[model samples]
Target: MKIKQLKVRNFRLLDNMVLNIEEDITLIVGKNNTGKTSMFEAINIFVKTQEISFEDFSQSTYFIFNRLLRLINQVDFNSISERRKEIVEKVIQNQMPKVQLFIEVEYDVTNDSLINLSEFITDLDENRNDATILISYESNNSLSLLFSFLNREKQEISLIRWLKDNIKAFYQTKCFAVDKDSDFKKDIDLSFKSKIEKIVSFEDIKASRTLDDTKSDKNKTLATGFSHYYRERDQTKEDIKKLEETLTNVSIVLKGEYEKVLKDVISDLNNFGVSTPITIPQIEIDSEFNSESVIKNNIKYYYKHESINLPESYNGLGYSNLIFMVLELTSFIERFKNSSEEKKSEFLTILIEEPEAHMHPQMQQVFIKQITKKINKAREEGINIQLIITTHSSHIIAEAGIDLDKGFDRIRYFNKIDGRLEISDFNNFRHKESDKETFRFLKQYLNLHKCDIFFADKVIMVEGVTEKMLLPIMINNVANSLNNEYISILEVGGAYTQKFKELLHFIKVKTLIITDIDSVDGNGEECKTDFANAETCNSTLKDWIPKKNTIDELINCNEEEKFDTEFIRVAFQIAEHSNTYVGRSLEESIINKNLIFFKSEYTKDAINKKVKSLFTLINQHSSENLLIKTPWDLRPKSSSSKTNFSFDLMTFDEKETGLNWEVPLYIKEGLEWLAGICMVNISEK
Candidate 1:
């Protein structure tokens, strides 16, 4: 049996969120305040405490309460007509706010223990194997009392304040079994508490782990953990007898030492009037050894380094955290296995929050890799252990490979869209077999270079080494605000940028794809932008964005056509200098925009001689009578390296050379739009 999904309603920011669980491991990732922690808290509340506080209610729930209060305040029960009063009462009852957790479980009836799951299965169909258990925290027979209180306090106190103060008293937690096939619900009795525990065992290792280095702290090392484990673990009769016998001998020797140490105290006590003639008070010490107490207080865990032994705290936090998680996981699994057959849970879910805490990137990667192996081993032992990890670490995400059967299907992206939590299941991101090669390339690319896009606020997909090296500078010059935002700039060339279209759309991050026009002539031969019958061969421009063929149409395409979706826009080489000239690529586009800068003395000395001569020739001619139609064709073959040209530009400092250049017009416009959109999004939030 496994938890297929969890639906949380009216719980903090997770107003109506559904998390689809993977069979083994589910990785939840997102930016801050997107309800990753709140989701965990809701589950923790339901599984452990069942104590729902007023603060736990979502803002939407408060709105419901406010509307209900106004309805009650406006009505007059004494003077209202029966029909009107009935309508108002029904609305109030229906609109009462509640926080609910729905746990959907899937099982194979042939293999699973129906004796354990029978109470929660309401479905009558033999073919169906899914069931839902709804644990709801809602008002219990307190509607009338709540209405009366609201009416009495309507003038004196705020409704929100009143609700906050008295909500727990009126509300209670209830569990119901729901049929998967028919959506029918059956109320489980009070024994539902025990039944829920037997179905799933939930544990969490929160981000704020206690890793105190102080010797006085009880939970300072794995030795302390062992004490708790020893208490819970069953011991053999022979082992118990041996421990008791050794402890008894030690206690006897300790008693003799204690008597000698307290000799003066014994004499003083005897001198006092505390002793009677009939029964003289004995001044002897009695010492006893308790195994649990001795284990808990006396054992200390140490790390041996070379010839020296150090305490566990002596290790770095990264190592300490890794060790701590291993110990906790082992303990959880052992405890589950140690439980009696009747009480043991069918599945164990371990939710670890930010396991990358205090760890370096490589260590984080190794920890995830090793932990996954450990979880797989536990599953091999016939224990259904589902590991859910919430992380902000790209290293861990990258190390968790994106194979469909592995990490890719298990990743759940949590995004906050328009004041609501949205979950995107990567498992649902399907691809055609024809696109299998593209998917493989994308997987490798992300693993090697761009996994950070998962956590970025915005993405900029640029065309090759030149754009990758120069985009940061261009962004700083034009869209300075982007420097402060989490922006991931990926170098996926024009030919392949279209491959990321589906993924970018799925993530829904505001993205700007800066690519080239890659103009070609009728025979599919590379051509200048202004060549007759010139068309773009770039896949992104022709097939994905703008969807234009001719250079004239692409260059004249309106800004609105550039937007593929609300979150994605494309930009390419366009007309510059009042539509006089058009560049076919980024290198030509740069020279066209900064002709005078390239013609300057400093640029001539800084650039390759052959490139400088070509730029000088282009600058000397008029736009209409230029000998070379584009800088792309005029450049010497020896100076054809775009990377070297970019490097030359990097050497020219505006502060030192007193010369400045601008980013191409198309890129500037796209970046400004991206910045504007990000600002609008921030303001809306």
Candidate 2:
């Protein structure tokens, strides 16, 4: 039987969160401290590999002293008469609020043994082949006893004794597995021990950070199959002696061989010195090769070079971790295979944290794609193994994205909502079945470099490479900070920017789209005359995003001329410095504001020469009195690009010139809006 779902309450960060586990493998991913580790801890505690500690209590849950203090703060002791106020204070100080957890677990009941063992089946969907069990565990504090102690008027009753008694009353967790049909209060005798022990077992392999050699490392005793070997065989006096003798014989043989070579050297040295003879020192051997030392001395890691052994530690960290992981995984399988039949527990949940710890990106992808199959093949003894991996690696997530056909729904996304942890299924982002097609498209498009958008606090969707290169610099200037907030500027292009709408919406990150109006004629060429929307601007946007009713409202607010906010979180605005005229592209919109800085820096520069020529042509062509109001106006009709222009602006020596490069009005406004919204979104939690 596999675990289907977990519902936890009053746990750390998981004040109320439900996690749905996929059958074969479930990948849990999120930013750090969003409760990825807490989710695992809740499950681990429920399954009892680990028990709940005092610190595991949710931040919302108050302890005895804190609860009493809150109550004291709420009361007006001065309002009552002096003696009565003292009694009111005593009453408030005497009691505390209790912290309780109501955890519900559901399992897919394929095994007959589990069905027979479970006395509390909350749900049994015959069509789905599943059974669910609800468990309620709580920390108890006796309020009646506290009231009794306060009501008694004894002369010289120690407050310390009363506090100690109340504190002890709340220290223990009372657990009960709840049955659906029966009264929950009456079913206090229910325990999960008989049910869980018969059906499931848990194994957690935390993120491995080995500081020393694996052979002697206590943290990874299974690295060389030493743990498995020890488990299978018992060591006695004879075993110890044999291990010691093995070491002794190897030492003696090596020492003899060394002495043969040293014999000639000593004689030659004695002749040269004309004094006492020098010789190689005798090799030392321990009297007893203990279990710990035996493995360290005998199980040496080596690489073969010309049939010679080289130390494995001599390799890179990536290689060492790869080898260590392989060995540990093999040992885990062997241990599962060799389990006795009488135990009646055959299921294992393997919790792996950051399996891509030391591996390169390619190896990280390979690990995610192949590790599950390897685990399944290794568990040939018919032991059921479920894999739950937590990772921050983009390569691994990409591999998972590619495997949508198999189990994309298995990926669990964890995020915090207003300081409370929320776990959502991967399918929650899929608005419809057609979104799976978009998923395929996105999976192909998001490579290692682009996939970093998934981790950013906020995102800005731009039309081309120019915006991607220049926007971050503009944002740093507007926000007046560098690297304080991570912003991903993706060049999704105008035509396909809508592809990421649902994804950005579901991730709940604020994103701004700085798109051009793209005013086009009937032939779909750039509009040469007056700007009017027929095949471009709001009409194209409306056609691209028909479902968003909000953009229709933005059009009512005159979107034909300038960019405007479609919504608070996701905004779409035309790239323009002024409403009087529009730029066809991002570079065109801001070029005028940049001319003064560029001209002063280098007049003889080749790029500036091209810019000057383009400006002269624009001035000659314009019949109207246009003063080159924006950068887009001076953009050349030829293949002259803005990438180099932006590069020059970014790399300009401000300290040498003692002048700051001015950011264009439109660009600055868009960046500031992005920064403001992102800051607000982040501050929400």
Candidate 3:
């Protein structure tokens, strides 16, 4: 049996959250303060402690209680009718805020043993194999008693303060077994604790581990683990006998040495105590040893490299942390294996928080890659172990791969939207039948690139290396507010930018896609921007945003039509210089906006040869007007290196090289919009 899902209500930031568990490993990833720790604590509270407090309640739930209090305070109880009084009492009973957890377990009826899960199953259907357990902390006090307490203290203290102080007096925790199909709940007696323990065993390795290297340290070490393992495992009679004999012989030798060392003192004490015929006093020395004590206090772990031997503390923290985690995991698995036959749990859950705390990227990748092998090794001992890892490491995520059936589907993304926790399961990311190849390519690309867009506040998908290298400088110049936020700039090019549409929507991050117009004429031949009957060859333009193919339609499209959603906006080349002409690509757009800068004699040797040649051609064509009738006529050809052109721009400075230039109008507008949205989001959070 395995835990299929977990639902939590009114618990801290996880006001109403449902988490679907993977069969073997579930990876929970997110930014800070998004309730990753709260989910861990919720499981710890319900399964291990069963303790609830006022601080555990969500802030939203607290406001709910305050509203209920106001409703009660406004009513005049003495003048109320019988029906009205009943309704008020019923509302008070039903509307009280409570923290709850629902654990759903799935079992195999035909092949698996039901010894641990049989008690929780109430359905008689032969096809059913699922059971749910509801654990809740609710008020147990009567309304009359609560009202009396409130009246006595209403004027003495504020209602919220009073409630905080008296919460434990009225609240209690209860457990029930719920039927899967009928939704009928049966109260499991106190024995429910044992039953639940037998169904699942939980172990948490918290982030803040004590890894002190001093001699006085009392943390878990390999030496201590050995003692624990020895105690838990059965020892043969022959081994016990041999150990006892060795200890006895050592004790005898130590006793003789102690007597010889204290011989002078013993004689003086005997002489001082003896008096004539009275019994003489004797000073005796004894040496005794307990095997367990000797092993626990005397043993130490060491690392041997060639001819050198050093203590475990002598190693660096990265290796120490890795070794410590392996030891802890091994101990947990061994403890499960040694449990009694009838009381053994069906599944062992190990929750590890931030395993990359003290490790480098390579070590983190190794840990993620090896975890599966370790778990499978444990299964060889007839133990079922389910692992949940909460991490902020992109390296680990990248190494896990993004295959729908085996990789990225195991990821659970936790995000906060409008001050409420939201969870997006990658397993639910889907695509149409025609987009299967696109999905496959995306998975491969993400795995190879190690993209951290999953954790960014906003995303900018650019067309090429030119945009990737120069966009930062543009943002700093025009949209400085975005510089302070976590923005991921990805160079997905125009062809594949639309492929990430579903993923961006799934994570719900604000996105700005910057691409080119790629104008073409009839017969699908590339043409200038002002050519007759021009149409866009860019897939993102024709199929994604605006959904227009004609150049005239696209140029006249309103700003609102460019937005795919409130969170996504697409920007491309547009008309410039009071709508005199339009540019087709980024290079052409740049030259159009900074015509004088390119025409200056100072920039003749500072720019790429192909770009300089294009500028010369445009200047030659427009000698009289100094403004080309068609800007796209002098566009750079496909042979020109855009990356080298961008590199040339990188070598100049506004103050030193007289290379001041403005961002294209479309990109600037998109950046400003993204900055405003992100700033508002940050303020709300």
Candidate 4:
């Protein structure tokens, strides 16, 4: 049994979000400030409702009353009497906004370990074995009559309260059907509260909580568990009484040994024939023995390595924090086991935030994997367990990967869209029954660059390594727009660029795809083809974007024209240029546009001896033959080799040609397009 779904409203950035839980391990991942933490907090608030603090409220909630005050004052509140202002202020204080969290859980009805929750389980809808718990923190509204005389304020308060309360009805949960305009409000009945208490063992391991302060205090660590296990579980009071008696007897015996050791030390000193016998001061040892004093005063945890023993706090933060997490996990599991079958619950949910904190990259990767495996092993031993991890570590996600067979999704993505928190589930991103191997490759590719896709304000996907290496320089020097945009140039190549189509759309970043126009001169009939597979224009780029949506005609005639044009017109320019490449690849296009630079930079043998003009050059060599390296060829792997060759030409242009190399028309047009779109968005903002 596990949490089947979660719906949250007015909780920080997550104004309204519904998340489906289909895996044993659910990874919440996204860029920072995208409400990943907010989602986690919402779950925490639901699971630990009695433990709510003022800080748990959303940032927007705190400003709600203040904003209302300003609005009221600006309109007509200044004309009100001083007594009216005080009443308005008092009412405002008590009418601050609220946050709510709703959770849908799937549980096994036959699990005897959860007998304490049997009543609530029976109360669930007869058609389904699921339950929905709506936990909310709302302001007390017992003072509604005070606003009646100021009738406008009454309407405002009533509407705001209705908006806050009725929005819960908008969420559809597993247990109940919700209409958008439904007015049902869930009060925590005894059965519902019992289910919340017994059905799930939800524990939150916050990132901010560290071992530094409590490492030396062994009693604080053990007291809760000790009290719960020995005192809470044992209905018979005789067990604690037996424990007290055993401790008292043990203390007396231990004190005798201590006295014997002191006497022996004094005797040894006298036998050594010292001039004066050293007087030893006797210290009082507490005779009264209780669990608190015994554990707190006598027991202390220390880090042991071979013959070395150091206090727990003496270790480095990474080691200590890992140990602390392990201790917490073990204690949680043991507490679940310690309870009697009738009182215990079978389902446990653990929420971990930023598990990579205080750990190195390698440790971060290994830690989560090991912990997840252990958690699954625990699940196999009869406890139904689910782990929720919120992380920014690509290493952790890569290690976890996407394994539907083992119930691991490819980490949900969260981001802010239109100033609201929106999440795209990994399960929805791809089909669950699809080939897992391709998904593995995608994760590996994304993990290689540490998922830089999250950092870009806009993204440019390119087919080759050369494009990835040189696009930044072109954007900076030729386009002069590097500072204006934060763009990620991903070298996913043409074949796999489609893998990121859904991802880019989810992040909602502007994306430009640049690929080579691998044209084939088939019997002098020009047909565009894919570079890798040699299929006639069957590229991932084609699959991702429609030809109709793109420019109808190629802008290839102006091989040297600059595009100081409208953003929409220039936005996808190079894709159109590819349509006009009769038989030229990106490398061929570069050489054709800058023949003088290529000819002067490379050896004379590298160029076709018979070729003199750009027109003759295209006619003489097919795209494939132009780049095929022979012994006489000066460049290695012509397509990729052009990157270094062009780089050299750009670097030493003044020395060789006594002028800076002119930016290629296609490259300039593409960069300008990307920059223009970014500039337009910035200006609009």
TM accuracy, model 4: 0.63
Model 4 off-target regions past 4 Å?
49-97, 112-125, 142-186, 189-195, 209-317, 340-343, 404-410, 430-458, 471-489, 502-510, 523-543, 546-552, 556-640, 646-685
Off by over 4 Å in 1: 81-87, 141-149, 152-157, 180-183, 212-221, 224-232, 237-245, 266-297, 398-401, 404-407, 432-434, 523-525, 577-579, 601-641, 648-651, 677-685
C-alpha lDDT of all candidate models, in order: 0.80, 0.57, 0.78, 0.56
TM-score (all chains, Cα) for each model = 0.86, 0.72, 0.83, 0.63
**Best-fitting candidate, measured by TM-score?**
1
Query: Per-residue lDDT for 15 in model 3?
Result: 94
Task: Report the Cα lDDT for candidate 4.
Answer: 0.56
Error of 3 at 45 (Å): 1.3
Query: Could you tell me the lDDT of residue 228 within candidate 2?
Result: 44
Prediction RMSDs, each to the true structure? 5.2, 9.6, 5.7, 10.8
Worst 10 residues of 3 by lDDT: 676-685
For model 3, state the Cα shift of residue 582 in Å.
3.5
The alpha-carbon deviation from the true structure for residue 449 of candidate 4, after best TM-score superposition, in angstroms, is 7.0
Residues 1-685, candidate 2, lDDT per residue (tens digit)? 6666666766677777777776667888776678777766776666664555556657665455455544555666557688876676556533433334343334455544555435545445465444445444443434334445556477366443454444444455444555434554324343555455556666666785563444434443233545444443434448856866787887668776766767776665556634447554544323333554557445664667787875654556666666566555655655565666665464666787878887898888777667766766745656677788888777877776436475346667776656767566766655546676666667667743566565566677777766777776777677655257666677787767777766665665556677654555766676522444434444325544322223224333332223222322333433234343444555554554545543332233445442332233333434232354444445644434466555655675576555466555555655676666333322220
How many Å off is the CA of 142 in candidate 3? 6.6
Clashes by residue pair, model 2? 563-574, 588-632, 590-631, 591-631, 592-630, 592-631
> Per-residue alpha-carbon lDDT of model 1 for 1-685, expressed as tens digits?
8999999999999899999998887889877789999989998998786588899999988778877767777777899899987787777776798899999999987778877778888867788888898998888754574665657646687777877887777788989998655758889887776888899999889999877666554466566566656665565658877997999999999999998999898988767675455545766678999887888677667889999998766777777787778777777887887888988998899999999988999999889888889889988988888888898888888877365446367789888877978898987777524477777877788887778787787889988888888888899889999988888888887888888987887878889999989889999998888899898889898898889999999988877788876788888988775557888878888878876666555433455333333344433434343444545653323334666677767766687556788898988888998898333222110
Any idea what lDDT model 1 has? 0.80
